[model samples]
Target: MEKNQKPLLIILAFFSIYVIWGSTYLLNKIAVNELPPFMLAATRFTVAGILIFIIAMMMGKSIAISWRQLKNTIIAGFLFLSFGNGVVVWALRFVDSGFAALEVSAQPLIVLVLMRILQGKKIQLMSIVGVILGLIGIYLLVSQKQILSQENSILGMSMIFLCMLSWAYGSIFVGKADLPRNHFVNTGYQMLMAGIMLAISSLLFNETWSSPWVWSSPVQLSVLLLIVFGSIVAFTSFNYLLKVVSPEKVATSTYVNPIIALVLGWYFLEEEVTLQSIMAAVVLLTGVYFINTKRKFMVFTRFFRS
Candidate 1:
């Protein structure tokens, strides 16, 4: 690929990540209604991991990593997938899928704070502005009458927030950790380790093989689509984009996902899309744009003045 073309590809990869991951929230809501959260997530990741690993092996990719690297990947996986996505699946059972999606979309802001506190990186002013706008967006999202009326809304939102935190922590750790040179191979290992951990957690907390057999065909199909689209394809695209783009640019997918999720929820679940939600989405997107684009704007200004 040409040098310039790489960026275009990365942009497309980011678009895929946003659309596919947004839809996963709604799919998760459907799947969890039929299967236990942990179990569903375990199965989803396990199947997706196996498929990815097999594909990697068939492509003559190295699946071998040092034990130390494997250990780090495992820990990262446990924190990111098992806790982050696992908690998301659990939260969807109690919260509206759109709400869950909105909450999780705050991951980039969480990542900004995590990077500052843990790595002692300087927080950029634009990122601070992004966080403020994102928080306001979150507030507007949760202010819906349906959400406010739910008795467990606080607990549910808290779980989703924790999910964002766990994901951000894992992402920061992974950025700092030494891993295999190949992103695909590293992602496969992470998924496998995370799947094992989630499977064990599922067994310990909510073991039930019977429900999988009893669920309707539509539910089974939804789970299958989630494994294929959400877990495998979206994750692989995200990993590829991470290698090709700046993390901040890749993080813009977070802002795009909530809008997609909102549309999906309205179409499939008949969820109401209020004006407040639309305004929140716009604010969140505007914040993301400013954070990602301010530096570019400065560069363009300098060029024009010269």
Candidate 2:
């Protein structure tokens, strides 16, 4: 890509991440109406993993890994996709998809605190404040009268929050591990592991797939979107963006995703957008923004002290 084209590609890639991933929440919700959450996620990831893995192989990316790498990836994959994504998909049966996304937006704060506790990383006062604000925002969201009135919303939201923590822990673990050389190939392996885990979970939960269970055209379309756009295209765009743009800039997708999810939920799914949810979204995203701003703040502080 030329210099002039690079900027446009970045913009387009960012758009893909923002729009495609945001839409997945609603699509997952739609698909889960007919399919069990674990089954739905398992099928989606299995197809995506195989397709992407084959593409990577064709492109000359090695798909082999050491035993230790495989073990670590299995652990990370269970945490990231089996719990992180699988639980979110299940929770959608009880709460709006946008609401689940809001809970996920709190992940950075949880990751910050986890890093402090597990890795003995320093907890700056600002990071602590971010965590606290994020907690309060989550409290406000879950304790909302609207969620309280709904059946199993509280349980669903709690599951989503737990899922976020799982994802954060997995992310930190993956960062510290020696994984495969290529990110795309590593992701394919991770998705494959997640698919296996989710499949086992579905069987353990006794989710039956009978002949009466029909996949409507909408459901089929939704699954296609999840596999193709959400998993493949958005992830490809994000990986590309990480090379071209600053990591912090790419991280803006954290805050952007929830709002986009909320809008799509309301417009497409007719999910309610309560004042409390909007308020919570503002507070939660603000907390995430602060959590992500740590490096910039540290640099500024050091400059002043010097």
Candidate 3:
């Protein structure tokens, strides 16, 4: 069992990030029908953060951090949550959904370049191919709409670019920076800090809802799912993966999420999965496979050449 532990953990981490996080898009879509975006995110993360903090304490994980560490965590929270997620949330108001998906799909590529440039990490050729393939697959998967022809289209695209950069930088920073050794503790602090910032922003902009927040079944269920799956499980898994694997590899979850999201749509919503969608999924997964499985893939290459 011990021998199988590391691979098992890696699989679990990937599953958490790829599937659970992808599912949140549907949840958020359903949720935004009732709640305003920033407030929804604020509530989700705040609640999730508190719950994770409590859980960490129960597990004997120390919740303490130095002032400097707290500062670092807050910066990460801003980058990953406040800017990365918040900007995307804001842009969705102006950007076409397909265009937004295309821009967001560039995250792995952004991370790849950032990792190479900022951290001076070397990327493998296969990984580059995989990221490109993933991007092409994503472009095919979504509607082929002209992105920048509308009013404020440039602004929307710029915000999404910032979103990708902030998220990529945050992932890299967390791996290098000294934070809470406990994953849950670190994530809890980060989420709480980001949630607070987003909530403040929402109020500063005078964002309002038509009704007082009521706990209808769908709203309650969406919030619960976001807390459990998105914040607690997927975010912690992301942090853990950043520690264990290359940040580029960790960022491959960007590509995987859309694939899982499409599958969920097909399964739950009875959405059509066209032949193009299937081909895109294959190309995307193939790219991801080559990118992450470098060593084993090298062996396969050698065998084929022989």
Clashes of each: 0, 0, 0
lDDT of all predictions? 0.77, 0.79, 0.74
Clashing pairs in 3: none
TM-score of each: 0.89, 0.86, 0.80
Which tens-of-lDDT digit does each residue in 176-213 have in candidate 3? 89888777899999999999998998898787744434
lDDT of 1: 0.77
Point out the higher-scoring one by lDDT: 1 or 2: 2
Runs with alpha carbons beyond 4 Å of true place in candidate 3: 1-6, 93-103, 127-143, 146-158, 209-215, 266-293, 296-306
Local error of candidate 3 at residue 64 (angstroms): 1.2
The residue ranges of model 2 lying beyond 4 angstroms of the native Cα positions read 1-17, 210-213, 236-252, 295-306
After TM-score superposition, the amount by which residue 98's alpha carbon in candidate 2 deviates from its true location, in angstroms, is: 1.0
User: Which has the greatest lDDT?
Assistant: 2
What range of 10 consecutive residues in model 3 has the weakest lDDT sum? 297-306
Better of 1 and 3 by TM-score: 1
lDDT assessment of candidate 2? 0.79
